[model samples]
Target: MDYERQPYRRCGRSGLLLPAVSLGLWHNFGEGKPVDSQRAILHKAFELGITHFDIADRYGPPIGAAESAFGRIFPRSLRDEVVITTKGSNPMWDGPYGKGNSRKHLLATLDRSLTRLGLDYVDIFYLHREDAGTPLEEQVATLDHMVRTGRALYAGVSNFSPEHTAEAARLLRDLGTPLLVHQPPYSLLDRRIEGSLLGVLEQEGVGCVVYSPLAQGLLTDRYLGGIPAGSRAAEGRFLTPDRVTPEVLAFVRSLAELASARGQTVAQLALAWALRDPRITSVLVGASSPEQLEANVGAVDGLEFTDEELAAIDRAAKEAGVEA
Candidate 1:
């Protein structure tokens, strides 16, 4: 694989430059699949210049199974060639400290996640989400400590509101440690982040690798005609038929038409639109198969969107009440 074919973008104002498209093992690289499949995807992604891979503590269907699989499959020599990012703070099961943004939970969960990943340190460790109950100070302090101790190279936060993001940045900056990135729900369907989160990231120099840029396949061509077998809408908990109303299909067709006019697929258009922003460091995508991974990475080549194309996409998305 020619890495030069996949464009790389600087992560905000940071010195780090990550591949524009990142491979996320949030869906199929977990339990209930051939372990070889997970290894294949990771190897394939790296070969395709997808230098960054995203995972989480509770990523597996049965929880921790994904990490265990990664531990078994990923080779130690290939580890330094990639940037491994995994989130903590989510509990695998019911427990007090099992879930929270408290310093104790973040530190403990990351330690467990590392053991499962079988690595001395993760490239980027995310806080998963903010805990209203736990003080932001504690969260930032613990993350800084991880960086200081070399348990984690850099720390980031996900699923945080713009206001909370600002607060966290302020807290970390005061401690002489700046937040690395913010993972937010972003896509043609979810534009809420465009309101202020994008603005905050610009002002704070915080990189953003938005997830679900396809709105869980809503923005894909998969549901344009109907939900196919093994489609996420049919097999996953996140997307449902209730989401594919007549109005949505109508919008989908129009969007697909718009994408075709540009000589790109809906998935390519959707992912490309996201990379439009300079602040966006990467688009974390979940692939159910290697074919899907190849198609998703091809999106990087189709990322040259004109202003007119963006305007048309916005109008079409607005008709369905989707944020573009």
Candidate 2:
């Protein structure tokens, strides 16, 4: 593997350096997908210098399937070379303790995740989302315990508002387990983070690793003509068919034109745009195939954008009713 092919960036003020394009096992690494295919994608991602792999306990259709699949292919020799991250806080089992940010739930979930991944400890363990029922102190303390107990090397949070993120960072810092990263959804279609969340991460010295960089394949050419037979939208999982409205298609077409001029795919353009901000440590990408992974990672080559191109991108987004 050409490690230098993909540049590594420091995650905020932390000593950890994650690949600019990390692989996420949110969609394809489940039981439905073939094991050999999943293995191919994982191998190809590592071959392309993607050392970070992100997963969540509730990522699979039945939950815990992705981790199990990953465990089957993950080589023990390469454990030291790769960064494995998993999250909790979503419902994964029966009973009230099945999911929450409480200490009981988080600790139990981490143990189960480790068993599924066949790992003693993950590089990062995140509270998947904010749980209002649980006090912020308890939630933050749970993360601290995870790190302090050697179950996780670092702590992270996902889908957190700016206020929650700031408080968590402060609490974790006081506990001597500084927040390492914040994972949020970001893309041309969704620029919600541009207003406040990104600012908080920068001020708090928390690295920002964004997911949905391709907007669940909307930013790509796959939906240019319309949703295909077996697409994410068709399955009505996270993205619905109604999301492929005419306005969204028009927005995608405009970006596709811009991408053509730059000799990049629309997906690559979206990834590059998300990574354009220095505050962004990495952009998590999900690939169903090795070819797709290669194409997405190529975004690193054209990370720069001319002022005029940036202006045009903003104009397209604004015209498509995307708020800045």
Candidate 3:
């Protein structure tokens, strides 16, 4: 348990200090697994300085199983030591109103999420995305209501564009609650956030905890030769086998070379690259086991990047079709 803590970073301009590396159960922590195996990953993450764990209602195949899994392991004594964040309104019901940014949906979804997680409140709750049908005011106010009524400590938005994020931030500030964070896909293979979302976060002081920092493991050495059996892309959906082409493998190898020079892994280097930006409050990662959680958590302490090293990473990422 004496693994190095590394350091905690300020969440945007907020008073909260979050670990540089946070664990996410968006995948892998699901049904058909022993509870102790999952609990071991959770505890090991905490033991390795990963204080934040992110989840969403639609985590498992049938949905809500991830929360229930955590519900089993979260004894009251360990609750205060960590930060738990989850998102709501991603379609857990058959009705049209089951998902989206509508006030009714958001509030109801938060309640269900809390019940499943076995907690009175989450450290951070996200709206998940923009609802084209729901008015911005309705969504913002509903989340604000959750915070006001003590359902969630701080509110966040994920997969939101810059325009929507700005409008939501303005509304939250007017209501005396600034949106605390923005969760986006940011990795060696994803840089869409750098164009607009980064600007929004900089101006609004809303922090970012980026997911897919390893590009769903494409940035890892496992895919450099061929997709391993049971790998994430092999499990396929969000990351497809089509994503792993000759060019993609070549780029991963190039990045692997860079990592080798630094005595690190492509996965470690990829996560470190995201954390290099102070604006990114944390790099949210997923783990299939306690060992994966510990190794990913180990990346934080070795995250330092020299100016030249940063440029090399940019070139490799560009070759991989990732916008630098």
Best by lDDT: 2
TM-score of 3: 0.96
Candidate 2, residues 1-324: lDDT per residue as tens digits?
569888899999999999999999999987779888999999999799999999999888669999998998998899999999999999988999998999999999999999999999999999999999999999999899998899999999999999999999999999999999999999988889999999999899999999998989999999998889889898897899998988899888999999999999999999999999999999999998999999999999999999999999989877987544
Model 1 lDDT at residue 146: 91
- 2 or 3, which is superior by lDDT? 2
Candidate 1 regions with alpha-carbon error over 4 angstroms: none
Better of 2 and 3 by TM-score: 2
Candidate 3: where are CA atoms >4 Å away?
Answer: 1-4, 319-324
- Specify the highest-TM-score model's number: 2
Residue 150 lDDT (model 2): 99
Q: By TM-score, how accurate is candidate 1? A: 0.96
